[model samples]
Target: MLIHGLLAGSLALSGTPATTAQAKIDCAEVKCLALTFDDGPGKSTAKLLRILKKERAKATFFLTGKYVDQRPALAKRTLAEGHAIGNHTYSHFSLTPRLDDEIFDDIKAGQQAIKKATGLTATMFRPPFGHTDERVLRIADELDLAEVKWTGTTHDWALKDKKKIKAKVLSLAKRDGIILMHDTVPQTVQAMPEVIRELKKRGYHLVTVPQLYSGKLRSGVSYP
Candidate 1:
């Protein structure tokens, strides 16, 4: 009876959610790099997932609620294939200029959408265009989400050149660096294969955002 009680207590302490028990990569033993994509589950995302699978790489997808509603299967697939899903807002609007209530609603809606589709609530969020302030942070805290930012980016949204995108990511790759890209961009999809290859050649481990910063995620704090 005492052994059973101890086992049940351990389970209770660990939380009853599968999301909480997901395995994480040891970033300390590996040259970890988090490849995070925002504004997606879009047209190019399926192909992006294929590339990631082919490379045996993992990533985090920060999905807009509108798109999650439109492409639920893709969002679900991201979770199915062991990638982390994060909230990128419902409308993908700039949170910096919005009212606190509006920001809170959009963020909450995004979380609800992901939960509805994937059966998992996102513990991470990245504000649209990396914009956020105190109000945004407070609302995120209420939602139990950690605000994530990027350590580097390919600037692929503005640039259509695939080679430049690949080169930029390679140049900026570092230990435990978070590389921001958009899965909605076709050029980004095109650039991802080579970038994955080159990053592997340079001895970097591709991991999700949570895996890259395991045990360090704090609500309301922005991780760069």
Candidate 2:
């Protein structure tokens, strides 16, 4: 998927407490960015979570159903630690090319898998490969999910180089920006510590997608 045309804007923080033990920050008054990971609660994810915990940074994970089934414990731990979760569809298929029923079934299955594993329904959805349209949005709305698109992406799965992935993420950082990366990418996981450090050094609060929007996300609306 291409990363382009990122618009600058601010969003409100949800009533949920900030991931850290410190005072909650209002995105409207402070610089905030939401870091989102898509695909896999894979083997590398446990390490990623430890890094985030150490850094006191929070993120949002969009889980694919197949992987969630394979790593249910990790999914539960992810939620237990205060990061937000979202559905990335059951099989990670590009949604626009699929029939309406096919699209609905996949997304619904994703919801079920996440619920079965974590016991909490996801309030967010992101279409695989960033392939989404009116129909996908409609179905997501029906499923009570707000569609989330990234403001920028590291494309770390393709880059594979930790240094390059870190550079891409730094270049994309901005107020209220939502950055896309993948926990399944080992190199990306390796790069996250320095990425989190630099973002904090630059005075940005790392937040979940819901926290970035102040927890008032509208169903079917595509977000920043």
Off by over 4 Å in 2: 1-23
What tens-digit string does per-residue lDDT give for candidate 2 at 84-125?
A: 889999999999999999999999999999999988778888
Off by over 4 Å in 1: 1-24
Per-prediction TM-score to the true structure, in the order listed: 0.88, 0.90
lDDT of 1 by residue, 1-224 (tens): 10112112221112221112234346776678888999998999999999877667777899999999999999988887777788999999999898888999999999999999988878889999888888888899999899998999888999878998888888888998998999998998999988888887787767677767665687888887
Candidate 2 lowest-lDDT run of ten: 1-10
In model 2, state the lDDT of residue 145. 89
TM-score (C-alpha, index-matched) for candidate 1? 0.88
Best by lDDT: 2
Clashing pairs in 1: none
